[model samples]
Target chain A: MYDAGKIISGIIIFFILVSFPIWISAASGTIGDVPELNLPADEEQCVEDAEWMRANHMDLLIDWRETVVREGVRVYTASDGKEYNMSLTDTCLDCHSPKAEFCDQCHDYVAAVPNCWSCHVDPGGS
Target chain B: MNALYAFFAVALLMLVAFFGVWGLGWNTLFAVMIPYAALAIFIIGLIYRVVKWARAPVPFHIPTTCGQQKSLPWIKSDRIESPSSTMGVVARMAMEILLFRSLFRNDKVQLEDKKRVTFQGNRVLWLGGLVFHWSLLIILFRHSRLFMQPVPDFMIFVRDIDGILQGLIPAVFITDIAILMALTYLFLRRVVFPQVRYISLPSDYFALFLLLGVVILGVLVKTAWKVDIEGVKVLAMGMFTFNPVVPEGIGPAFYIHIFLASVLLAYFPFSKLMHGPGIFLSPTRNLINNSRAVRHINPWDYPVKVHTYEEWEDEFREAIRGVGLPLEKE
Candidate 1:
């Protein structure tokens, strides 16, 4: 007779690996409450739409870094015909000042390290 | 003819990637939506294929053995090759998976001077295959840095080792070159060898060409057109977290690379590329060679009605008496 034990165990292992995200999410319970960003109280609008910013803020910052540092271009024109300074500290931090409360919230939830603070100083440094 | 079709198919895919991202500027579709869809398909399709294979009952113990079976106590058994026991089977599978033992032993027959035939060890294909697979694995592992935050130390170590020949400004990884060269060799082998070319189907060529396209695009991304690294990480992280944000400022080249990769993923299970997992499920490779030691009973075997010799004799007793023949019943 064929050994059924090994086959069953293999199937179990396959399920465990494949359904890892499900069990992990169930165990962590953080899937329901993805961390929310603390918006600035004074600022009314950003360079782009909120959804666009949420998706592509890092890319915008990266482009800003290259233009400002490499090409020495300081002004950035948004798709909405609005012009803004291309400085992370001067432009972005002016609005999203508290890095820990605002940036770290979503970043920690997603486990993404932008590595921006390594060079640039945090405005709300503890 | 099949090869030409496959070549055109691969060209079409490249064209799709090029036009989809560069011409149409559909970065979100190429980067986020397609990848997510492909991943879902890959996972589900792989699981379905595996389950379908597993459910099929292998009633016979038909293990292909290359060495002598365990029979006489005096004779030495080739445990790794024949694999009569469970441990032997495990060892055999390990060797098969890790070293590609069967491929390593590949022999080629050549007709010399139109009279003499000579068998030569064909290690080139084995070497190409081994290097291609290993390099691919390492490259995939190294890419984990893009997916994971605070990239693991082991991954870093692997990256360092892979890029040990650090003369180039961006630092060239050994696997990058190895995979390209190995893929080229494999492709060339298919084209150059008449026998291989004769047997090669469209799917075979398509898989190879697609993989080559993916590797070339990846290399171009790393070397020629640099994209926003942090943005890439952000995008990868978003995907992992189920938030899937398409990052801006990443070059169209990156979009093309990702689209090609996504297509490969989506096509993986349905194509001949499924041999990666199918190798494990192969009864010839996985089964133990213990037919001599134990009788293999088919699980589906059931009893059936049959006429016995005694019953036949009893029915024919009257005819036998009439013919003056001896009967045990009478």
Candidate 2:
């Protein structure tokens, strides 16, 4: 059998579930103390500084000479945890030092006009 | 129990937040402090895990390889099965991790009509896993669009290519569909198959449930609700720079999505999900096959002074005479 009744009930539940975001958005202002995302619809959203990212503070730097048995080169990908070292030169930002050299070169290769380097650094090897 | 625990933890947090907001009207605490706290936990937890993993020193060269040993030409051998060369090992690891080649050919056995039967070509996991990982990679790539300022050309190109359909509103992307299907396949496979379910635990189920939750909620907020996309981007950008501000017009649903994502981040390095980084760190994967070329003395083995045979003979000379045994140089 098609089971129209069961399917219909499911559809009804689905709509209510789907409407959750709408409900929350609508309730933003009404519910006392709810943080209203009632952003002025006209507010031209400006690209703000990447505020969420906190600088990694740990001295994760590896002593290259000792670990990798090299004079200076140290950082290996974490996969070589035992025998390898992590160095700053391997940081993602080193090559993509500037947008033109590091970020834009490859991004432009694929034809991407990046805004990331404007605000954030490259995936510099940590 | 894992699902139940995860669900209850989520529900409890929601209820606490709801009440806190309603009762105290602590907008700043809810909107600002909690996110900062979560981010702190996330960073600390991630660092702790990485540091712990790094600090663990592997004392031996134990790279898991599959290829021919660099032995004598007369010593006939299968190269890929037991690799003893760098090139051979690299090829094997690459195939195993990137393509999941071994898993694709992996077999599962089950009883059929009282016969020990092996099912061949059972690649649901390998295929599902490949889809999930590949799709996730593309999705993460696509998300880079938000963090950029002028927006890089390649990202724009990818954006355009992803929306090549050119017909859907909000520009439906290939990765979105692919990730959805991938996660669905993974989840369904776990639930539908008896063999899989038999070995499945709450953690496995939780991984699927959590991913599904994120995907479902993401689709809900993105597609149907007509969310303020610009507002979300502002919040994301602001957060990335450490000036974490709750942008206006961003819905609570966004918080739930972001919150769940943050939870996943905090859980990542600790969870088996960390196998991404863990796989590479594994001594079995990174160690070079140099046993034949170089002697691997276990660095920790203490050297003990050996007693010479002359010293032993001297001590046992009297005992030997008592037993009428022959003596040397006597």
Candidate 3:
């Protein structure tokens, strides 16, 4: 009975939880790309390939110890190439520049405080 | 006392940080120094966590596999859910990372007669998270026009798409609603769910509140109180090129918004919010499940003298003969 009740409650929450994605997909389906149907099998690169990636993408490597950080979760690759970890960079700033007409107009329209300009930047620095 | 004291201290700091913008006239620090500090904290904290995890020894090939392992050809295997090969693992990771597939699979229990398994999608959290992220991205895109020497076309395209509604005064953008709803949902979920609430801390609420405060203040500065946007562009351009100087005719609310944003950035890496990057480093999600077919030798693995089967058999050959067991050779 208890398990059953838990299931019911879980189901309700699940539906509520699902509503967000469904709604988002329905609304903003046009933006971004997600390859869901035809997925690859191997997630990790072979040892040789990993080595090649390291050699080619040296800029990706940084000193973890001296680097600034945020959370309890860890992602570190050893200098010896024995350990490899990856995390997505925070790409929030690239779009929200203060000089851009797109951000200022709309952010202004809604009477919102725009923070895109605080740091030093040009309007379009391609 | 430590916990209570921490909460009040945080409250005090937030208040001070806010007042420094409104009252203390510390515009330079509010606009610049604080953001750098937060960014530093985020980077340092993130590295600290990752290094710590990297140091934890995982000798075994333990991946939370859901598909078929590479085994005897006669046996059928589930490939996508439980990946035995590297390609399968990649696909699995793609699904897990890009789409919250695992969270999507989360089942809710139902009770009436028999135990019911309702197949309602459980991706709302993921979607809200996505909305917040994507909307934030677009907002950033729109902002690029202000700082760039020559505005990018893509920025213009994205801005048009976001502000497609352009219905009322100043052209209403979609991000306003998206961010608002996303933030509300995340915040409400924390308060509503007992399980989530149990783990909820003041910092979590503070992050949401702080973001909300920035958004609100932004709206105020933009529509409610229009500021010199050209001046803002000059100020921002100067900041990016490392030649920051106060722009003339910029409003105080702009400073407030800038200060709060700086706070968000600096606070980003140290808070639980840093999970944005931590997900990729997760061993459970990233590690391949090829243990049965392949040996995963640890780089830090120490040397061990292992006895071979033939060596053991060599010693037991005489004993086997005594027991009348067939010998391969003789």
Top candidate on lDDT is: 1
Q: Model 1, residue B191: displacement in angstroms?
A: 1.2
Lowest-scoring 10 consecutive residues by lDDT in candidate 2 chain B?
B224-233
- Interface RMSD score of each model: 6.2, 23.2, 19.5
**Which DockQ values do the candidates obtain, in the order shown?**
0.09, 0.02, 0.01
Error of 1 at B235 (Å): 0.7
Model 2, A35-80: lDDT tens digits are: 1222223434211212211111111222332465455555454432
What is chain B's TM-score across the candidates, in the order shown?
0.87, 0.76, 0.77
Q: State how far residue A13 of model 3 sits from its true place (Å).
A: 37
Docking class of 1: incorrect
In model 1, what are the clashing residue pairs, if there are any? Answer: none
Count of backbone collisions in candidate 3: 69
Q: Model 1 misses residue B146 by how many Å?
A: 1.7
RMSD of each: 8.4, 22.4, 22.8
Flag the better candidate by lDDT, 1 or 3: 1
Question: Could you give candidate 2's fraction of true interface contacts?
Answer: 0.02
Candidate 2, residue B228: Cα displacement in angstroms equals 1.9
lDDT of 1 by residue, A13-72 (tens): 866754554455446554344445678888888988765566567767877877988999
Q: Which 10 consecutive residues of model 2 chain A have the lowest summed lDDT?
A: A50-59
Residue B118 local lDDT, model 3: 56
Full-model lDDT for every candidate: 0.78, 0.55, 0.59
Write candidate 1's Cα lDDT for B93-167 as tens digits: 888888899998887676888778876646888889999999999998777656654555677678778887643
